[model samples]
Each structure stands twice: as structure tokens, then as C-alpha cells.
Target: MAQLSDDCFAFGGPMMSVDDAVGLIAARVSAVQERESISLHEADGRILANDIAAPLPLPPFTNSAVDGYAVRGSDLPLQAEAVFPVTGRVQAGGSAQAPLQAGHAMRIFTGAPMPVGADTVFMQEDVRLDGNGRVVVPAGLRPGANVRPAGEDVAAGHPALKAGQRLRPQDVALLAAFGLPHVDVRRRIRVAVFSTGNELVSPGDRRGDAQLFDSNRFMLGALLARLGCEVSDLGIIGDDRAALAGSLEQVGRSHDLILTSGGVSTGEEDHVKAAVERAGTLVLWRMAIKPGRPVAMGIIGGTPLVGLPGNPVASFVTFVHVVRPTVLALSGAAQEPLLPMPLRAAFTYKKKIARREYVRVNLRQAPDGVLEATKFPREGAGLLSSLVDTDGLVELGEEVTRVELGQTVGFLSYASLM
Candidate 1:
């Protein structure tokens, strides 16, 4: 396996700035080129690796938007109670009858192809049926009503989806509308997860020797899986240099990405960062963002590696803000916008201009359809309950030193949490 220069990770007054770290990572990274084709039913949550165009128009025909009577718009007499014979019938997915001659109407249903020469539809509710099976039309009916023209929903050969687009349920439905049974998507990366600390014990195991439960492993693992990565849970690695290096070597060989928690901080027992530097580059990134100030990024062998803080909340925040973008980039996704919907603040807060801050907050709709924000009671980096209690994050920019009451701020949707 490949490794970095022995002294590449040597200390130099903290590693890289947040902006600089992201730049370095992005500079060294590119999406994998491999593609995986799957059926539409299985493509949800997958990222498109190639451009997808409509094989055909969504409707594929001029159809009715409602169940009504189809007729020649001018045939309906301009006067009250104009009547016409029901020439034929059209149902959804059914062929049209013989073209309507002038002064004739046809019974139609929603999604049915509009018969030729039928320029308009008078809704059943708008017309009264006469004893002769003909229908009376209201005055002032327009030329075309309730007609869904062919290619109206989706144009033939239009770009139905773009490469790097993440497929959602609606996207799958769009594919089905094009008669596509399969989709082409980027191959999901296999990420191997592990943690290193003799002081850590797995869940269900009794703790001893200044030990704590290994929560970050499971948390990060689940997050990676939800992002559509195939994850290999390597559990925990004890703090022996050989064992740590061995585990890293194994993961680097088998996985496209290797993620580890803890051991990046400087302490006698914290050798994760040292081992990474010995085996590969482990650049520490002291971000401008708070509660997740300590972030590490570098390449391990041919695989990318991220080292997050041991604090659960710090790990989560760092993963979302810093690591999530990198993962999405490597997975060939169109980058998501960072700006959230601007919201009015319900509380006041202050911060240093040099450092960015992410405040966990809950949102409630006000009487006038505006969103009000409330901060969590506690704001510690290790308090997992803060994440559980809050709806989403309020990002305070690096320049703004203080925010006053009721000032408008950007609020990210909690619906974004996954």
C-alpha cells in the first residue's frame, strides 16, 4: 500500500485553515469513473453517473387532463344550451375513436388521448345531459380546456436528468415516465470504519480503565451508509502502533475510503494521527467553525481518510460540514448549496469575527408563516442530546461578530438531516 513521507504530517502551528483544507482535498480528489446500471426500482438514492434523457415524451400523446366531453370548440353554439351528439368514447391509455367532425362531441376520461378535431373539453359538471344522450354546453367556453398536449409533461429528448444528480423517489418516477426500466449511476464507494483507543469499549461491553463506550463508530457508520456508501465496520483498534497500522493497511486495500475517530488530538495515548502520518498524510485542519474546530483530512494509500474528534457532537458536525461534502464530491454528486432559507432570529448571540459558529436550533412557524428559531439549552461539543433536541443548524458567518434580536439569519432545514 502507498504511504506519505514520514515527516509530511509534521507539526507546523496547526495544519491547514478550513478553506485551505477543503481546497487541498478538492485538489487531490476526483470522482471515480466507474458506472453501475440498476433498474429504476432500485435506483432511489443513487447518484447518476451519466446524463439521462427522455427516451420519449412523458405523456406520449395529446391527452385529456380531466374526465369530460371533448368537442370542437367552435361547434358549441355561442348561444345558451348548445347541444351536440356524443360521437364516441376515449379512456386513459385507450385509442381515440374516429376523428370528431364539426358539431360533434366525444366522452373522454382523464389521461385519454384527445380525439382529432376536438379542441376543447367541457367538464361534466359544466354541462347538463339531455334525454337524447347529447350534452348542453355553457356559453363562453374557451377554445381549449383541460387538454394535455403531447410532450406537455416532458419533451422528447429533453435532458430528463443530469449526470451527478442524486436520484430521489420523484426522479425514479421521472425515469418510469420515460419507459426506462434501468438507470445508470455512479458506483457506490465502500468505506471502512474503525476507531482507535484503548480507553474505548464497544457497546454491550463493560467499561474499565478510564474507558468509554464507542459511539462515534456506530454514528459515523450509519451516516456513511445513509449517504449510499457500502460500509465495512472494522470495529475498534487498540492503541498499539503495529495493530493500528495493520488495521489501516487492511482498510486502505479493501475500501475506497477509510474513516477513523479519536487519536488525532495530541496526547500520549493518541497515536491515531501519528500512525496516519507514518502510513499516509494526516493534515490537521483547524476550521473557522466552532464545536468542530479539530478536523483532519488526507490521503491514505489510494483511499481517502478523515479523522474526526472523539466528541460525539464534534464528530457529527465535522462529518456533515467538512467530510460530507468531500464524500459527495468523490461519489460524483452535484454539489448541494450551502445557503439555507433566511430566517428571523428569536434569540440574540455573539461570537468572535475570526471564527465561524454553528448554533443548533429548533424552528416553529409563526402566525404569519415565518419561522422562529430557538437555540438548544446546552451547546457543548460532546453533548449528543443537543443534536437530538435541535431541529437544524443556524450558521453564523465568520465576519458577523454579533447578531441582534429578530435579525434575519439563514436556517437550514432539519429535513436535510440524513
Candidate 2:
């Protein structure tokens, strides 16, 4: 495990903006240098450690793009369709029997290598075979028609996938096409997640009158898993400082990062910040973002820690905005920019504060073919149903005070984050 510098989060300021917080994190944190070579079967969702270059051109040979007749373009009659004797036949995975002679045609199947001296292909549908083993080719057929040139898909020695790319199904198929059995990828990140509150209980546990089910840990665990991390659930911890400190110290030495929900805000019951300070160091305390503001970032026993708010929506948003990027950075993946699509606002919005805000919105395509975003009926951070009912979020900048109806707003889909 690598420890960030002491001043990594020592920004002397009040609540930090989302951009500044993300920039600071990206600058201070370094990728884990460890890498491993794994089989392509297990490479999906793994980040590439190095660029993968094409060993050979994708096709490696000129072939027919469809079932057609290979012939010399200049040999075709200028007036109308002319009959030419079928000289040879070629099928996929087999070479041409011989060079195509002038005024002759060769029957070729899709993916079959083009015969020597043949520069054009006519689809079988465009030609007819006579009873005497002769094929008629249309005069209007263009040169190189239905022919797949060599290296059409990918050129030799070109990069097929770059470093820090997370392999998807198509990427694996590409590697398989190149006959690469294994790939070098970054090792999975280890993360420990826990929730801090005396009133919280696990789903399977019997609950008291005042106890609520601990939902943040499960949600965080699933989110981390989706990010391709190995998650260790530390379960729910009470507000006892000694127990919290002990758990933090124990997991800090084992995991690459620590993530906890609750006990981060300035309240009497909040003890996570104090326990983390006692165990190691608290780097960042707060962020100037709505739905989630009291996010605490620190280091414990050299392991990075992120403390999210207790509200379900706030925790989800904060994890997507703050923790997700940090996890990717630490795992050696490239920082992916969040590009939101512009959509028309269906309702008015007003926020007097100068803080960045993310509103849950459901998108609908209006009858005029324009997409519009409508805010959810409720706006409480504790309302988990808002996230379930909405398509994504509408991001408002820090200076924006009001949003007029029909105004274009930035819309980020939840699919993008996933």
C-alpha cells in the first residue's frame, strides 16, 4: 500500500468545490504500480497496464465482402451484361485455385481471398449462371465493388487498445482475434466499507423500535463491486470511539481504501472524524455540493478513507462524484471525463445558495422531438425513491441561481456512471 503525502489534502479553505476536490485528489493520489498478466477470459472489466498493438492487419488478405463473382473490371462488356466462363471457385478459408484469366469469372464466397488479377466483385444476386457453366456479369458494376481490402478494419502495428482502458466484451473479442491469450492488467483494488451508527442494523438482524436497516453499506458494497473492486464489508459499527478506531486501524493495514457512511458531519453523535484523526490523519472535511456536503476524506494506517453522508441519496451522489474517481485513480485507470447531455428543463428551479447542486430528474421526449427533464416531486436527500424513480441528475453550476422553464440544463444519466 502507498501512503499519500501529509499535505495531500491540506487545502486551507472552507468547503471545496467539486472541481477543486476532484483536481486535488487526482493530483495527490498515485496509481498502484502493481500489475499482473491474466488470461483474456478473466480480463473483462480489468484496466490495461500497457497499450495493445495490432500484430497483423485485421483481414491479413484481400477478401470478398459478400458472396460474389471475382472478375477483372476491364473485361466486362461496355454495352450490356455479357457471359463469361466460370474458371474457378473459392470458398472462405481456402485460397484461389489460380489467377483469373481475362474474360473469365470466378465464383467466390464471403471472406474468401480475392484471386490474383481480379480487382472487382459482383454480388451473386446481380448475376445469373447460364446452363453451360457461364456467368453473366452486369456492365454497370463498379470496380472493387463488394471487395474487402486488406487491413480495412485495423492496420498492422496500430494500437488496438490503450493503457488504462477497461476491457469490455468487444475488446476481448479483439484480443482474441489477434490470438493474444493473455493481457497485462492492473490488479484489483481492495476496499473496506462500513457504516457508523448505533441506530443502524443489518438487514438480517432483528430490529428494535428506533433501529433502521443499514442500507449504505450494501449500496456501497454493490457500487464498489461494479467498479471492479474487492470489497470487505466491516459491518455496522456503534458510536464507540475505541471500537471505531480499532476497526479502522485493523482494516487500514489490510485494504487499499476505507469507506464509511455516517458520523462525518458536525454533530454530537458523529465520531468517525475524531476516530480517523486519532488513528491517522483527516485530509478533507467538506465539499460545497448539494445532497452531499459533509464528505470526509483522510488516511488511516496509510490507507485512504472516504466518509460519506448518512442520507442514501447523498451517499450515492457523493460516491459517484468523489469516491468513484478516487477508486479509479488509485486502481491505475485513466480519469474519464463526465460529459452530460443538454436537455430542456420542464420545470422551474431556484436555489439561493452558491453551491453546486445535483437534482434528480426524469427525462421524457416531448411531442416536438425535444428531450425534457422533469424534477422528481420530492427533493430530500433521505428519499431513496427519488433515485429509483429518476433517470439521472441535472447538474447546476455554482453561480446559477434559477433555472427557467424550457432552459437547457446538463443532464447526466445514471447509466454513464455505471
Name the candidate that leads on lDDT: 2
Clashes of 2: 0
Q: Candidate 1, residues 225-301: lDDT per residue as tens digits? A: 78888889898898887788767766887777788888877778888877877777676667767877776665677
Give stretches of model 1 more than 4 Å off.
1-20, 366-369
- Cα error, candidate 1, residue 245 (Å): 1.4
State in Å the error of residue 83, model 2. 1.5
Candidate 2, superposed: residue stretches over 4 Å from native:
none
TM-score of model 2 relative to the true fold? 0.98
Question: Alpha carbon lDDT of residue 278, candidate 2?
Answer: 87
Q: What overall lDDT goes with each candidate model?
A: 0.80, 0.90
